[model samples]
Target: MLTPYLAMFLDGRGLNSVEIGQLLALITLTRILGPNLWANLADRSGKSLRILQIGAALALASFFVIFIADGFWGLTLCFGLIMMFWTAIMPQMEVITLNSVAGDAHKYSRIRLWGSLGFILLTISAGRLIDWFGTEVLLVICLALLAALLLVSTRLREPEQLPDNSPHTGSIWSKLKSPVFLGFILALCLLQVGFGPYNSFFTLFMKDLGYSGMQTGLLLSLGVLAEILIFLKAGRLIQRFGIKWMLLISLALTVVRWALLAHFAHLPWVLIATQCIHAASFGLTHATAIQFIHRYFGRRYQSRGQALYVSLAGGLGGAVGNFGAGLLWQQGQGATQAFLAAAMVVGVSLVVILLIPSRHLECASEPAR
Candidate 1:
């Protein structure tokens, strides 16, 4: 929703591309610290739902400050605070949902598709609203959405886990050290690093290439639409191909997709074609990795499991990519250069995945129950 308007927003506030990238990097950096801490808190207290609710409430409140903040630094302060609270929801929520489904954790895909659907609907609607009313409407609308999320939070019950039968107190460190799991995270970070330029600047890039606002929205929504479909079938795919293979393939495709983006920005069909890869690049990789966490980590450590995944890959790796891309972007280098660098990141990630042993994958055969 904020994608198209970000360049304009930052430009209006006197930030160049590099400064905008730096701030975006910082926003994601919060997840590196915030999510792991919150997940650990939830682990000790068995209050994942409560933590989620509190984060929602805080997110709703922070937007009030965001709407009123002036200048880059003020907005940065507001964004930092808001992200610190907002980043905790997904990791723990994944743990909750995995626990909820129990033996049929493969059904996670069907459940997660809703988020992609929400993004598709909101992205299109937000574009139309911004075009009709102007970009300033963004904060007000986001505030309204957060208010609704606060209400939504109240209705969600904390997920229940199967009672622990083992005598040994399990540590998250042991669960995380499985080389396959670490390799998976490294691969995803590279894949997402490739996506950094696309996420932060795609709308502006399309506009520069002469696409209309509505067209930009359609293109963005198209990728999410593909994601929705892929997510619906993720469980089956994970069963058929296994997580390690899935990660490797997805990262490989990410390299190709970003290379295409770098080389073919002006070709309409190429733009559309590149987005089809969302299925593998994001949907498959995300679903597979989360499933691995569920398989490797028991219910007691699930929140921390998800948090580790989000923090290292989506948070820190993504921040590095976004910031680096921003520097390249501000140098007056073309979009192609940013995407090419992303492709390189993914390539390195692909090499890292080769070192992961497949024996750790035996757990995928066991149901979450």
Candidate 2:
């Protein structure tokens, strides 16, 4: 709901395209700062569910103030507070979910597809709601969802503590210091940087292309539909091609997806094809990343590992992507250039992913459970 519509919503609130992009950059920046804070707390306390519930409750409280925020500063401050708390929820949640499934990639994908389903349903209906009522409805919808998150968090029980007896029991810094892990984090950060333009502007870009709110939502939904399917097959794909190869494939497809969108977005059919590859671009890439990180870090440091991914990859990379996309966008006139830049960044990440040392590969040969 937030990703596809926030640009449109801020536009309705009288913000310019560039301002909207900057606001998004700030929001993503919170992902960098917020998660690290919560991750440390959760790791120390050993209560991931409690951290998530607190984050959700705070995020909802902060977002409610959006109703009274009047100008750029007000809007920025309001959203910053909301996202600061909101970004903290997911990393902890990922740790909990992976623990529940015993790190089974296939089972994890099955559970995660429900989120994609929610994205599809909400994106489809939000567009219709916007077409009928207006973008202000975004606030109400977001508030309600945040409330639901808080409620759900309260209901969830943390997985039972398991004895982590694996050999590598060094400090968190030792795990962070590994060359392969560094490469993985850097590559993910760059890939996310590449994602900046599409994520921050695709909805607005669709509008500029003369697509209706409903069509824009459908286009976004179509990408997620593909994402859901990829997620369903994630385990098999990992078992067949292995995680390393699948990472490269996802990045290469993303490069193609963006380049095609840059040149052929006006071609509605081309748009559909690009959206279809979102499965590879986002779904597969994310699934593999989660599995890789789960296997890479020891159980004691799981929350921290997930937090670092969100903070560095999603937060830092997203900040650059959102901000740079704003500048390249030049108020929609430079959409093509913005997208091409994104493609090039992802291409760089493709090379970076190759830096993963062969010694640490878990799924390169053996079948994933």
Candidate 3:
């Protein structure tokens, strides 16, 4: 719902590509700052759920202001505040989930699959709603969901801390300075930068190539569907291939996938086919990274470790990529050229993965229940 309306919202305001890109960059850059700040508090208080409820409430309230705000500055202010609150939700949720799964992290797939399922259901329903009622409906529905989530979130209890196995840690900055950890962060940052344009403008790209809105939703669904399958079996794949290998494979596949879409988005089937690679490009990479950090970082620093990773990779990388893609998309160099640029970034990321030290790896089985 948010995906489709994002470009339209800016377009509705008559903002140029550069302004749109900067707004998105500003929005996502909060991801970098928000997570680390909240992550530290969560660790100190061991109150992930409390952080989530508060953040969600703030986010919900902030976004409601968006429906009434007009003009660029007003929208930007509200949106930035909303993003600051919103960005805090996912990293903490992830930490909560990690705590819930305890030692048998492999089973994360079973639970995480519901998120993908929700996206599919919501994407289809939201698409239909937009088709019938228009994009404003999307914002209204988003506001409603956020409000409902804020209410329901209070019921979630924080998981009891398990016997933490992670190493004792210093400051977040020192951990980040480790060569291997630094390498992984850099790789993920580059990887997301490559993805920024696709996430920001893929629908427009499809429409430009003459695909209809319904087809665009279906194609996006295909990517999620592929992700569902991978989540179901990602543990087995990770055990077989290891995190480093999985990371390499995902980056390689992303390079191929983005390159194909860049040049061949005109063919609906071809784009659909390329979408299947999301399983590796997104699903595998995500699962592997989380597990990898769990194994490498000490239990005490889990939140900090995850936040650091997300801040650099998801926050910084995503911001740069979003802005760059916006500029490229606006330049009218066409989707093909923009996608090719993304592919090249992923290619560089693959090399970075290859350089990470093998000594940091330590896979331990969860004790039998």
Candidate 4:
């Protein structure tokens, strides 16, 4: 909801493209630091729900300050503060969801799919609303959503724990030192780098191509709608194909998706068709990555694993991608070149993933249900 219109809102508020990119980068940058910090507190205290509630409260307060924010620095400060708390929510939620489902990793998708539905509803409606009411309405909608989050956070029960028998790991740092784990993290980072241009500039790109706000929202919703369908079937797909194969397929589709968008933005059908790839690029890949983190890091370090994923891929990778895309887009090379650059980055990630032995990429065995 807020995503599709955030860049536009900043633009409407008089920030130039570079400034908008910088502001977006700040949000991602905080993800790098914020999640791990909060996760450490949650894991140590066994108080994830409490932490979530506090973060939501702080986020709502910080975001409200955006109403008064003007110029780059003012908006940057407020958005950064908001993200400091907001980024903590997802990693904790991932841990909570995984814990609740116990050993049935497949069920994770069904629980998470509702989030995709929410995203679709908000994004599509926000687009139409923004078109009708102006981008300033974004702040109000965001405030309402945040307030709802705070209220909901208070009701979330502690996750039920599964019985554990696996040997305790030495430390997260020791596990991080392994070649396979390092390779996986690096590959994930590159994948997010590939996503940078699309995340930050796609809406603006569509508008420049003369698409209306409703069309922009519909296009975005189309991708998530595809994502929802994938989530509905993701459990079965993972069981059959394995995580490694599914990840490879996703990377391949992402490559094609970006290329098509770069070269054929003029064709509405091409754009619409390309949106379907979101099922592969985001839906499958994200679900698989969460499963991988659960298996790879084990239960003791689950929160840290998720935090690392968010910090590296979403945080560092996204910041770099948005910053680079903004600079490139401003260089007169146009959106095509930025997306082409993204494709090239993903190509590098493909090579990295290919280097990992197939055995290391195999899905972990399920625990007893």
Best by lDDT: 2
Q: Residue 190 in candidate 3 has what lDDT?
A: 97
Q: Write the per-residue lDDT of candidate 4 for residues 247-354, one digit (tens) a residue.
A: 888888888888988898789898988899999989998988888887777777788888989998989998998888877776334788888999989888888888
All models: lDDT?
A: 0.78, 0.86, 0.78, 0.83
Candidate 4 global CA lDDT score: 0.83
Q: Write the per-residue lDDT of candidate 3 for residues 130-167, one digit (tens) a residue.
A: 56776677788888789888888887888988876554
Error of 2 at 169 (Å): 3.3
Structure candidate 3, residue pairs in collision: 166-298, 166-299, 167-298
TM values, all candidates? 0.94, 0.96, 0.94, 0.96
Which stretches of model 1 miss by more than 4 angstroms? 1-5, 164-170, 361-369
Question: Which TM-score value belongs to model 4?
Answer: 0.96
Cα error, candidate 4, residue 290 (Å) = 0.4
Q: Which segments of candidate 4 are over 4 A away from where they belong?
A: 331-333, 363-369
Candidate 3 Cα deviation (angstroms), residue 295:
2.9
Clashes of each: 0, 0, 3, 0
> Which candidate would rank higher by lDDT, 2 or 4?
2
Residues 1-369, candidate 1: write the lDDT tens digits. Answer: 465467656666677788888888878788799888999899899988899988888888777986778776887788888888887777767877877887354578888998889988887887777678766777777888889988988998877657743232457676567566676777777766877888777777876787766777788889889898888888887788777688788888888999998998778899998888978888888888787766666667777878887888888887888788888886345588888888898889888876766665545445544
